[model samples]
Target: MGMTAPARWLVAVGSLLALTACAGTGGSPGGGTQRQIAVSTAVPDEPVTLTLAYTDDPPSKALIEGFTKRHPNVTIKPQMTPFNDYVKSIKLAMSSAQPPDVAQYNPGAMSSLVPAGLVLDLGPWAKAYGWNDRFPPATLETLSSDKTAKRFGTGALYAAPGGLSVLGVFYNKSLVKKVPKTLGDFETAMQQAKDAGHAPLSVGALQVGGFQIWNALLNVLGDVKQYRSWVYGEPNATIETDGARKAAETLTGWVRKGYVPAAANATADTDAQAEFAGGKSAFLITGNWAAAALEKQMGDDVGFFLMPGPTAEPPKVASGSSVSYAISSKTQHPNVAAAFLDYLSSPEAAKVQFEAGFMPVDTKTDMGGAGLPVEIKAAFTPVAQANGIVPFADYASPGMIDKLTPGVQGLISGKMATAGFLSSLQQSWNEHHGS
Candidate 1:
């Protein structure tokens, strides 16, 4: 089965916590008296070999091919790991005496490496490559953290996104007659679908899919800065707010109305997608990463849209993330690795990233095509330009996913109240980042 958004976080955070001991004891990778690597803006003519450890296949493998084709003298050896084993294995692998030159960056899984000084700071390289202008500021912000990795959006840069992902709504045109123009219109459409003897929405309450609905609601209704601050672990950040409560209540209201399937609590994300593709449901809320399989299954019968706000205009914000990578501190070829990272922002790489079923980090590059990809680009470009793409709520802390999965399940099953659900999420946030 295709990997779901929830499964990605499970593998990322679960593996990171399990191997805490492998993290380095040093300060932030950028700070301290660490020896500086001699690097240049130009790729070396001499023969060089570098290794990369990563989990995401399409962009990773395809990007490597693009980089090597440009610099034939440089050979890159990639070490691929399953998503489940990647966090734990990469931690040990990066901390080893002979580490890969580059590794994919997971804020949850590889965060420990920041303080341990196992990963390169990349600040110098960022300046050299002018990455500040090349990549999106928000994308780079998520990859950066403080010495303890507790706070983000400050300090030296760690990684660059090879590809991006956005969360939005996918509707079956065969079931829903037309697209919704406002949140009210959206709800009305859901009711209309339910009234017609079709499931209004296919939700995977068993995993991240359940909360993803809440996430979309919150994005349309809530303040983007407040949510971003909380996810970045700002001081005194809290998730227990009016907008959050409303989001919870709204989700529960859907359950009460039978718009969301009662069996959703038992259904996994892949199953939910399957149901939507099978035309059992009118809509599915998920990231663009699922676009390929969904397009293949539903074809022109499906269409995509951002979750609209109260008015006719869609919300400026959406929840999304990137498939990003970082350089290892112990690598002998920092420049070569930095060059590979730089290539991520190029027009060539943008095409490869898009063809491989991901949004390119170079948002300005044209991803011209047809169907869902075009629809996604149309919705995604404006948001990216406005810096409206924010990380998912579960990314606030390591244990937050543990709270979200069960809390959303409770909402779907009618076993938990709105206040209880919001309180549970706040408890997890408070535990990791104090009130």
Candidate 2:
């Protein structure tokens, strides 16, 4: 499950506030003297205690336990915050005198920390741990950013992922008899479901779920580099292109054809998932994060698939995110923190991540599971191998989510034209990135 529209808005505002707060401080917020850290691949033998601040439960708590078991001398004090408070509070916490050594990375919410030089660049540790081989390149790309933190994909690495996730389609096995192999087949199946008096696609158009569907469509139809460039905030990158227009049109077309529920704009993500789980709709577009809940409700009646492209050979592309963490620049035990991050890529840690309901960062590691997990792995492995997974488009700018959520709702309600909706998105991009 992705962050809700309100959550994303909060993160954006929190990020701006963080940046403004940092600027007022005149330097790194704590005003500590800068110290150079010597990169080391090994953790110290002496007893050491480090603190970590995070929001997510499963991977964070489990990963910490795994790391402590391996290095008994080291103790990690975890400071858990709720997702709503995490973004706003974390900035202040990280800027404090006794900051956590390790903090979970929230790209949209914590990006301001990068420009303030409050987070350590993990480039040296990445090489020392051979992380390039340990984690998928595509996963790392989202965690890397320039010193300004505005551009992504080509800069010093800041965070390393503990767990990964991928976006795709989920179907009610009773409604969709055969899995769709091509985009045409997918539409036809949706139409057939509609003809049978079922809502073909369950959508939460009031939130991130709406734009997520468009995001998946663009991944399969658009130029990968162009989309990447736009999301990464590269110079002259623009989202007002043919492929994006086509994707918007396609989403609106589905709504006009009655394939999507009429009440989608009023629905919440969890409610949409509930409806799908109850077999009210034939299909749902979402991430692997929802697999556990779906499996519990649908049992063997649920199936997963990558969103197919126009051709039989579907595009090897998808949108995803990670449960990743960065070392605070103020940490005294940088090497120990690096060791913990490195441990995340290990086979043992991979098992923990998978069991915790996330895709393992180490794509090569075998995640042996039945049903939905297996289906997810089957779809994700090849994409990871080809380095095709990309970060969500809302990551482009702080206000981008504000545009996407309502823009999609407009499309669903027939309140805004495709061109107008797309222009509204570009306008937000321009306001953030500048014309």
Candidate 3:
């Protein structure tokens, strides 16, 4: 199909800006960067095959199927990698002579790709598809960053979200009799569960799951802008604050009360989830990405809610991230690669995303399902509508994860003080952002 006059105008404008950005950056490794390519809204009728290197499976594979079904001539070949290996190896793959047409965006990997100019700046395509209006503004912001990629939330657009996710609490209905109205009430429930010989919470302090619990608490307790500015790498930003300290104290208190597992530091996230699903724990603090598996295991016994605040009524804030994708600058077919991204905001794609246990990029799409998803959607709507979602704390710096995971483990093990935990994270942020 030919482009309409308005679409043609958008293409022209997008092409001009993209060309300027690419030229300033120059060639990538292996001399594979396309610095002079033109932007277009059309894909040719001839058969085309594109390779996508990704770690996340369900939504990645399923979304590809949904896009290719619409354009039968296009074939997407996926190169799956384990998440741990993908983050360490993707930079080399993207810098190769024959790079995948697209790859799932990883902050660690993209930190190198952005500076090397190995990933296409998707600003032009974002404009052509009116992505600003179609997707959540904050979701898009996390995918963008400065040319150096040292900071996020501004500069060239690099990716589009395939699926959205939020961090919250999941409870076993048989263990908790009612939803807690406040943070105090929530603690009371945990105490009751402990008295009944049930572990109040299952924590996976051995990995990111440990820090995620602190993050969910920080979302409700900390000032959203302060945390966001710190995560986005704004100059002079600091994570050492009263709110952050309070959040840290709360986590340590959970440890003292015997609410967190003694073996938390040795538990992997999947193991923690399995323990909860098997009805060994009353609650598990995790992302919506775990909903599908937990639903299958526990059936009608699983429930979800954002972590309650100190007061009965509090600002709806939560930490979240997207399974977003970026196109390689070496790809011969940028337009075709971008078409798949455009489809991410469509109604059909929304259904596929939700069914695969992810929140859709189009937050407005009605998730016409029941059980755990319905509960998640109900808890998620107000936060997204209020624009209260913030990026994960690990996004604060490339090395922030290194500090967070272990710092949280120390807290669970009764070795680290709250002040020390906050300072360790701030130390990593300082190293990256400059004090």
Q: Write the per-residue lDDT of candidate 2 for residues 157-214, one digit (tens) a residue.
A: 9899989899999999999999999999999999999889888998988788899999
Q: Which digits, one per residue and each the tens of the lDDT, describe model 3 over residues 67-158?
A: 88877889999999998799877898988889999999999998889888888888877766667777778888899999878788899899
Residue-level lDDT of model 1, residues 300-391, one tens digit each, is 99889999888998667899999999888878777678778878877778889999989887787776668889899889989987888899
Measured by TM-score, how close is model 1 to the native structure? Answer: 0.92
Candidate 3 Cα errors over 4 Å, as ranges: 1-34
List per-prediction Cα lDDT, in the order shown.
0.82, 0.84, 0.85
With candidate 2 superimposed using the best TM-score fit, by how many Å does residue 196's alpha carbon deviate from the native?
Answer: 1.8
TM-score of 2: 0.92
TM-score of each: 0.92, 0.92, 0.91
Clashes (backbone N, CA, C under 3 Å), per candidate, total 1, 0, 0
Question: For model 3, what is the C-alpha lDDT against the true structure?
Answer: 0.85
- Where does model 1 exceed 4 Å of error? 1-32, 56-58
> What is the Cα-based lDDT of residue 251 in candidate 3?
91
